[model samples]
Target: MEKEFYIDLIYKSFSGDLSEEEQNQLENWLSESEANKKEADVLEKTWQLSANFSKDFEINLDAEFAQLQDRIDLDEKGNVQEAIVKTMPTIRKKSWWKPLSVAAAVLLLAAAVFIFNQNPATAEMLAMETLEGEMKEVALADGSKVWLNENSKLTYPDAMNGEERRVTLTGEAFFDITKNPSKPFIIDTRDAEVKVLGTSFEVRAIDDEIRTEVVVKTGRVSLGKKNDLKPIELTANQKGIYNSKTGKKLNYEVKNLNSISWQNNMLEFNDLPLEKVLEDVENHFGIKVILENQDLLKCKYGSLFPDAKEAEVLKGISSVFKMKLVESGERTYRLKGGDCQNTSE
Candidate 1:
């Protein structure tokens, strides 16, 4: 049988277009010999790469196949150079009349790459930005959310369809990422690379500043510096600070809410009663908080609730007080069943 039959089967397999019978035939052929398996592997890689290329440019498959056999390797200008594929017999045939060897398959991929990258196009970059005194909320395609602070910029692909969801940031932003263990989220900054898999955190990497700070609100975040500094993992309320000028990394528990309140609408308290915290939340987010048990109010609370959402602030307060948060009325939450005896600050 012509090798095109097997190559067709391999390409069909990638798109899940093969029938059970075709699959069986392909499998049987693959198990026939090591050479066949290796050839199939090469064909599969070529098909995938060419498929990606085809999305950007139309594929004249027959034309590509015919020309690829004639030469290999792209010049500095991405023009195909004349290089003979020794495996191809000198007796040329018509469009796909002859079977494609593994070398030809490899050459076809190279041609597609050169042709696709011929002009050397820059990647299409998309950006979301916030000006001075402006705060913007952006929802990512991956269900991740970002609250960009003033003078901040976040540039990312139209689709974060890679092994990792990556974006570049300049200035401060709070990210609430969707959990996908298979795909980690990465934030590239001037100083470090912050990686996470489903977490809520704030990253401050201003252009004019030498300090890059990451404060984790929930879940875990990995902070890796561009320099030789060791990476650090930050958990709930943990802060990681990297000084690019000093080449120093410092991580500690989050103290006072710093540089994030602009986006969070957060209320920072040194050491205040739960009642006072809720009072500030009420004023900040235009929400009211009711305590079912009066004792819960006496429980002192002081932690950063760096989420712009009103409910989240109340939820954080209730969690600290061990109270059940209930949205009893519009713009009002009732903290049900709580005690000061088990309170934590």
Candidate 2:
């Protein structure tokens, strides 16, 4: 088999593009010899590095690729292979990126030369990012489930073999962590960190963000600054916030249960002030709500909307408040002709 055939197949395999026969062929190739298996591993590792990498700058790609080309060259004529693998690196594109060119194949092969040469601690972990308006669910090696909100990024090891199951996060994600008291689950958000033995929670700490928050859905979470010995413990139905600018650590009872509504699109308000309720609605549907009468803010509302559309939810709220719903503009609304009342349901 031509070396490029295996390279293309390997890329397709990682991308889930391989048909049943192609998958079997790959398995057969790997089983043929340990050399084939080792080469495949290295290329795959290189593929992961390009996804998103910022680490050890020791091994220069040009120098390293030159060395690898000399060794891995199978065909007596190695000039073509040398030129293709010399292009710029592109490991990751989208979540499930496909093969690009022979150049990318060579890049992956070359990167693996140094990437796996380093110790496990120095290896660049895999990264996943969701674009805006896209949500993704990921399962970790430790059996934990992560529901990543749109515009969020998660960096995790290929396997959870350390004393602690650790991951780094940017943006927001709801975690249904697998319980493992021995190996606590830790999420590092640059300035802040959340340690958990086994619990479910939602964390929001954007890049260069001020407020690093964790809302506990189940179990307990220890929230604190990165590398800080002293941390605030949060229980279920609790929220912890560490403000980097103010250097303040705050713990509060979780009032809004639908804080993870992005995962399920469920809106739940428990006797919340009209002003606060509208804020959540606006955030979910990206629709701005205006109260024609400030008195409406005095009213408290309680309801549960299960997978309801924006229009349906707004109509329900209007009926409950005895108000008229007016569409002011695209993705904007006005609640007028309403009287303040204890609208609890």
Best-matching candidate per lDDT: 2
Off by over 4 Å in 2: 1-124, 244-247, 306-308, 326-329, 343-345
RMSD per model, one decimal: 29.5, 26.6
lDDT of each: 0.61, 0.68
lDDT of 2 at 332: 89
Residue 110 lDDT, candidate 1, scale 0-100: 8
Model 1 bad stretches (over 4 Å): 1-123, 227-229, 268-345
Worst 10 residues of 2 by lDDT: 104-113
What is candidate 1's lDDT per residue for 1-345, written digit by digit as tens? 777898888877787788989989889999999999999888777876886653477876654643342232112112211212432354133232222211100000001000111111233457888998788998887888888777777776666666667777776677777777798777777656777743566666654444555665555666766434568765554556555554555555443343345555656764577777676677666677788898766677766554557666677767766789888888888889866754344
Model 2, residue 290: displacement in angstroms? 3.6
Question: How far off is residue 97 in model 1, in Å?
Answer: 67
All candidates: TM-score: 0.43, 0.59
Compared with the true structure, what per-residue lDDT tens digits does model 2 show for residues 1-345?
776798789988878789988889888888999999999999888998889967766865644654443343323224433533663153223221222111100000001001111114844487788999998999888788888888877788777776777887777777777777788777776667778744666666555344566666555667777677878876655556665544566565545766667766888786788889898999888889998878888688878897958998899888887899999998889999778666453
